[model samples]
Target chain A: MNAFRAVAVAMLLLGMQGGGVPAVAAPANAVDKPVRIDIRNFAFAPATLTVPAGTRVVWTNRDDEPHLITSAGKQFDASRALDTGDTYAVTFAKPGTYAYYCSIHPMMVGTIIVQ
Target chain B: MRDANDSTNERRRHFLGCMAWAGAGTLWLMKGGVLQAQPLGGADAASAADASFSFVQISDSHIGFHKEPNPDVAATLRASLNMINAQSTRPDFLLHTGDLTHLSRPEEFDTLGQLMSEARSGKVFYVPGEHDVIGDNGAEFFRRFGERQQAGGWYSFDHRGVHLVGLINVLNLQAGGLGSLGAEQLAWLKNDLAGRSADTPLVVFAHMPLWPLYPPWGWGTDDSAEAMSYLRRFGSVSVLNGHIHQIQQKVEGNITFYTARSTAYPQPAPGQAPAPGPLKEVPPGSLHRYLGIRDVRHVQGRQALAVTEEVLS
Candidate 1:
C-alpha cells in the first residue's frame, strides 16, 4: 500500500508539472473504510472529508477542552459534549454533503461529503 | 548536610513569600463620578476607607483541570479565596466571570462550590463560560450557580448602587463564528437597562470578551457591538470578561473592557501561539504569576468603580 501510494503521488506530481497545473498537492487523506476524525488543537483534522455512503465516521476528542458535535443544517443528531478521549460516531447512509461544527468552540468547523 | 538542607528550605520559603507580595494590585479611586487608577498597597487609608463598597472578580478556575503549569487547580482556587477572605477592605460580593470548571462535570462544579463557599464576600455572581455549559446547554450550571430562573442564564441586579449585569454569550454559538449574544438576550438587555438612569454606573460581566480583541481565535463576541450601543448612553460602563486566560484591557470612550486571567492556567497572548487554549509551556514555579483575581471598589456617590488585579504569586 505504501509503495502504491508513493508511486501514485509521484505520477500525479509529474502529471501536474507536465500539464502546467496549479501548484496544488494531492488530497492528503482519502479513506474508503471507516474513518476517524481527530479533534486536536481546537480543530478537526481532515476538515473536508469524502467517504462512501455506508461509511461510519467517528470523531474523537483529543484536546483537553471538550467539543460538542452540532450539525449546521441539522443533518444529524447532535452529539453530547465530548470530553478528552471521548468519541461519537455517525453512519452516513445518504449520499449528500453535510456541515458540522463544535458547538462549544463554534470557530472550529468541518465538512463531510458522502458519495 | 543538614545545615545545607535548612538553608535551601529557608531560601525557598523566602522566595515564596516574596512571590506572594511581588505584583502590585491596582487601587481604583472613584472621585466625582469617575474612576482613576493607582497602586493599591499603602494608598492613603482616608481615600480607601471612604469608598462605599468593594467586590472581587475571580475567573477561569477550571477545577477539573489537572495538567502542566498547575496540576491542582482547586488548590490555586482555594488560595484565591484565601486572598479574598484576608482582604483588608472586605468585599461585598464576588464575581466569577466564567470557566468555573474544565469540562462542566458534576464533581467539578461541586468542588468549585465547596471552595468558593469559604470566601468572605457576601455573594458570588456567576456567568457560564463555554467550558461550563457543555453537554446540557448549561442545565447543570443553572441548577447550581444561576442567580435567576431565566432561560438565557443572563440576569441583572443592583449592588451598592451600581447596576451589575451577568450576560451569557456562550450558548447557541454558530460555526466559524465568535461568541454570540443571541437576539433573545439582546432584547432582554434592552429592557433590563431601559429604566436605568444614564448617570448610573454599569458593570457588565460575561464569559467571553465583549469587545473584539482577537476574532480569529473566538476571544470576542459577535453581537457585542450591538450590546455596546445600548450601553453608550451610560456615563461609565465597565465590562469584565474571562476565557482568554490572561489580563488585557481596552478602553473606548466611556467604556472600558477588561479580560481577567484564569486561576487554572494561562493561554498565549493574542496571535502569540498557533492556537488558543491552555498554555503548556510555562516554566516551573512561575505559573502563579499568571493566575490571580481582581478587586473592584465603588464609592456611593461616584459613577465609576475602581478595579485592582492581583496575581496569586
Candidate 2:
C-alpha cells in the first residue's frame, strides 16, 4: 500500500507538472508586437506582411490627401480620415488573414497575415 | 440691271453663310466650355448619330482636400454642375467615374451628396476610386451609393439604345497602381456583354484607365486587357475613366478611351514630377480651370461617339 501511494503521488505530480508546462509555454507563442505601415501616393509601401497574433499595426498617411485603413467583410476599420502626417493604429487580436485598404483610396491596399 | 440684282443676291447669300459659321462656332465654344482641346480624330464620326441621350462624367472630386492646388473642391464641383445645367440639352443622368470624396468620410460623402443634389441632372452613378474605397472597402460609400449597383457596386443599365456598365476596378489594385477587375467581376462582365449585339453602343465607366495611361503612378488598370477583350465584339465601345485627373484620349480598334480631369485638384502629369501627389500650389485660379465634365453623344449607325470634355474656367 505504501509503495502504491508513493507511485500515485508521483503520477499526480507528473500530471500537474505536465499541465503547467503548456500553461507557461502558451504565452511565449502569444508574443504581442507592434507593426508599422505607410500610406502614400496610391499604394501601400509594404504591400504584404506577416505578424504574430496580438500585433499592433500602425499606418501613417504620408500623402497630401486623407486615407483610411478598412477591411472588407470584417470589423477591422481605421475609417477615420488620416490626413498628411496623420497616424492611425489598430492591434489585431485574432489570428487570420487580414486585407485592408484606404477607405478613401480603394487602390491603396495592404494585407496582414496573423499567425 | 440683271447683273446688279445677281450680285446683291450673291452678297446676301455670302453674308448668311458667314452668320451660320459664326453661330456654329459660338455654339461649339459654349459646348466646349473648359480648356479641353477639341475632340480627337474620329470623335466627330462617333457623334454622327443623333441618339439624343446625354450623360455627365464627373471625376476626381477630391473632397476634404484643402490645399494650394485646388483649395475649393466643392466650389469646382458646383461650377461643373452649373455647366451641366447650362447645357443646351441636359443630360439624362450623371456618372461619377470614381474619386467622389477625398477622405471617404461620412461627412465628406454627405457634403458631396448635398452638392450633387444641386445638379440639374438627377440620378448619379458612382464607382469606387482608390481614394474613395480606401478605409472600409468603401463601407460608407457602399452604404450610401452601393445599392445603385448589383455586383459589389458594379452594375449595368440601358437607356436610349445605349448600355452603360459601371465597373469596380479599384477593389483589388495591383503594384503598378493598376486597377484590377478580379476573376469574379471579369466573369460577370463577360456574361453581361455576351448577349448584346455588336451594334449596341457600350459605354463602360470605371475609376482607372482601361487603356495604359501611365503605369508608374498606378493610373492604369492591370486586367484591362481582359475587360477590353470582353468589349471587343461591340462596334462602338467607349471607355470613360478618371484616375489620371487630366483629359486624355486613345483609340484602339473600336474602343475610344478617355480620362477626365479632377474637379477638386490636379496632379502633375505622369512622370512629370518626382512622385505623384496633389501638385504643389499652382497659380491662384488655375486649379479650377483644369476641372471639367465630359459630354458624350451617341449617334445612330455611327461607329464612334462624340466625346467633348469641357473644363470649368
Candidate 3:
C-alpha cells in the first residue's frame, strides 16, 4: 500500500516539476501520504473522507471476514473480495465526491470527497 | 510426536470453542429443524440408495477467487465433479445454486465452464447468487448461461414426475443484504405451480435460503415466504439453496429447506463471526469436512426423499 502511494505521489511530482526527483517535501505532504481506511466489522472506518485531489487512500481489511472497496459509479473496478490482511488502494485523481460500497455486503457504504 | 499431536488437539479445541460461542442453540437446528412441526425431515426413515432418478446439487463455486481457506477453488470444484463422475449411477443433471464466480470475471466463468464440462451429469442448471450478479445485473452471466430459463433467469423443469423450479432471489439484495425475488418471480412461481397436481413431487432451487435461516447475516430470502406459500399444497417439497457455505436444513410441513456448503470456502456459521465472509486458519485437512455435495434421489414410492451429502475429502 505504501509503495502504491509512493508511486502515485511520484507521478504527481513528475507532473508538477519536470525532469527532477525532489527529495524535499513541499505541498506534497498532504496529497502524497495516504489516508488509511480500515475495514472492520463489515464497515469502512471513517466511512467518509475529504482529501485533496491526487490524494491516495489505502483500505486494509482488519476484520476476520472479507470485504470490498467498490465505487458506486464506474469510477473504478469493484475490488475483489479482500481477505483479512489484504489491502486495496484507490487514488482520487480528479476533484469530485465519489460514493462506494462493498458489493458483497451492499449495506456497507462510504464516501470520498476530493477538492 | 505426542507434543505435536497435543498442539493440534489444542487448536481443534480452540476452533470448536469459537464455533460454540457463535452458535448456541442454533447448532442443533442443523439436523433437528426437521422436527420443528413444519415439514417431515424424515431423517429417521432409512434413506434408500435405489432411486429411479437422481440429481446432484452444488453451490457457491466463487471462481476467480484467490484467498486463504481455499485458494484453488477450481481444484475443489474439480474434486466435486470427481465425486459426481464417480457416482455409480450418473445423475440426470446438476444444480448449481449460485455464486458461480467471485467477482464475476470472464476468466472465472471460463474456468467454471471448463470444470463443469468435465462433469458426467447430463446438464447443469444455474440460479444466480448475489456475487454472480455483482457488476452488471448479471448480463455477462445471463449471456453465457441464461438461454434456457424462460425469463428472469428462473425456470422450472420436469423429470420422472418431479417438478423442479429454479428461483432467483439475489437479483435485488434487501436489508442486511438479504436475498430478494421480486414480484415478477413470485407471480411467475405462483402461476408456474398452478394446475399441477398436488401429488407431483416438487424440488425448488435458489441461490439464497428460501426460509430465513438467519436474518442478521442475510442468510434468508425476504419474500420467499410468499414464494413458498405457493407450494404448500404439494405432497413433497424440497427447497435447496446455497450462499451460507454450510449445511443447514429445516422442514416445515411438506416443505424441506436445505442449504448446501460451498466448494470455495467455509463461512462462519450464520451469526457466528462478526459478519459472514470466509472462515480461515482451519486445522490442516479439515477444510474438506466443511465442503461437500448434496445428492437427491427420487423413488417412485417412498415417504422420505433420499437427500444425503458426501464430503469433498
lDDT of each: 0.76, 0.66, 0.69
Q: Which stretches of candidate 2 lie over 4 Å from their true place?
A: A1-59, A67-81, A89-115, B1-51, B147-149, B174-177, B288-313
Clashing pairs in 3: B38-B252, B38-B253, B39-B251, B39-B252, B39-B253
Scored by Cα lDDT, where does model 3 land? 0.69
RMSD of 1: 9.4
Candidate 3 per-residue C-alpha lDDT over B154-256 given as tens digits, one digit per residue, 9 for 90 to 100: 8898877778898888775532356788899888899989989987878888888898898766677778889888998876777888888776777676777
Per-residue C-alpha lDDT of model 1 across residues B69-135, encoded as one tens digit per residue: 5788898787667756655776677789888998899999999999989987788889999989887
Per-residue accuracy of model 2 over B99-140 as CA lDDT, tens digit each: 888767788889998988987775888887877775477778
Model 1, which residues run further than 4 Å from truth? Answer: A1-32, B1-47, B289-313
- Model 1, docking class: medium
Point to the candidate with the largest DockQ. Answer: 1
Top candidate on TM-score is 1
Better of 2 and 3 by TM-score: 3
Model 1 C-alpha lDDT per residue in residues A19-105, reported as the tens digit of each score: 765445544533334688999878899899887676689999998777888999999999987878999999998999999999878
Tens digits of per-residue lDDT for model 2 on A1-115? 2234445665677687775533222233333435788876657779888776777788888888676677754667545777889888888789888887654344566888888
